[model samples]
Target: MKKVAFVVAAAMTCVATGAQAVDPHVAVGSAQYSIGISGFVPVICRATVDATVVPTQPGQVSLGSLNEFCNNPNGYEVYADYSPNLGKASLLVDGQKVPLGNAGSTRISKSNRAGIVARSVTLDLPQDVQSGSISFRVVTL
Candidate 1:
């Protein structure tokens, strides 16, 4: 009878409990942008190229992945975190940019304050962005 009671209790517990799932979690409130670039052209590294941003209202970049999009009332921020395989890398926003000389497999993140209006980005990149899935921007530039 004791064994029967324990089995019953276990079954009951199982019925009362819910299943758990392993879901990818982001922080309380955070967003991200990830891009993949290939086919690097070192010659293009020194030239300034424009990377444009498209507006996504209440949107996040590359959902289900590391990158995300969001719409906040307290002003919006755009970030481009890049990992390039070749050449020098520099990030430009409006007019301010930072240059990184001779880097490999590196991630550099830049934040620019923005609003609902889409804006233009200038880049003096080391290697021309080859090819990769982008969480933000047009992705295919």
Candidate 2:
């Protein structure tokens, strides 16, 4: 009987210690709380052009690839502009002639959905405008 009593006391002591060891972060009858997290990525578009290459035709200047990137779900457009703004320069992409705007910028291509695209671009400059460069612009729609 004495041994059984000692064992019960020891078991009660262990249970009491274990109960005290549990520390709660929240109050006993209080409402629970939670931490919320969020993030954002802004809509963006970008265009990159590689180095100029020798033209296969005598009067045309061939340029390297024009790569485009856009994240807008609607669409994107690629434009081309030349240096010196020399009178109505002609822009060709993959051998197809792209119409020029009066403001000196022309839309070379467009996409209905967000994606990455690449195309070959070329320029036909006037004889008066020698030694010039071409630039590209990307717009998210």
Candidate 3:
């Protein structure tokens, strides 16, 4: 019958090329995964000062002496910013004002994490600290 219809049309073209090589477009899908994270406490902190300028004679003027550091594990305080002719200066370490000054900062060392907590400050010159010119600075509040 015409060579059996050319062998049934070449066996239906080899079964349609083996059904397109079996891939058949089956991409069964499902996908989902996630991750996200985030940080800051960085106001670290630092301060240092050391003084001993000698040229004394009015009441033995001596407004000099300090050494400080604050790494801030959440603890720090030591301030003395003066230049108003030092008419109102009072900051001690082993005499008074351990934590008793507001506008001039007098809370010297209390909280510490040991990163940079070194202190040795003394400058109580208030007898009208005079000598012609003056300046001071040691802060980390």
Model 3 residue-pair collision total: 0
> Model 2: runs farther than 4 Å from truth?
1-39, 52-58
Candidates' C-alpha lDDT? 0.34, 0.70, 0.47
Which stretches of candidate 1 lie above 4 Å from their native place? 1-70, 99-114, 127-141
Query: What is the TM-score of candidate 3?
Result: 0.24
Ranking by lDDT: 2, 3, 1
Worst 10 residues of 1 by lDDT: 42-51
Task: Point out where model 3 deviates above 4 Å.
Answer: 1-38, 44-71, 91-95, 98-107, 113-141
- Tell me the lDDT of model 2 at 131: 58
- Which digits, one per residue and each the tens of the lDDT, describe model 2 over residues 29-107? 2333333345688988998878654433435676778888999999999877755453356767888887554566668
Candidate 1's TM-score reads: 0.29
| lDDT comparing candidate 2 with the true structure | 0.70
Candidate 2 structure, TM-score to reference: 0.60
Clashing pairs in 1: 36-132, 38-130, 38-131, 59-69, 60-69, 61-68, 61-69, 88-126
Which whole-number lDDT from 0 to 100 does residue 127 have in model 3? 57
| Tens-digit per-residue lDDT, 1-141, candidate 3 | 999999997886665556545645422223322222334656555555555464423333334445555565555555544444444545555445432233433345555453454444455554545643333333333
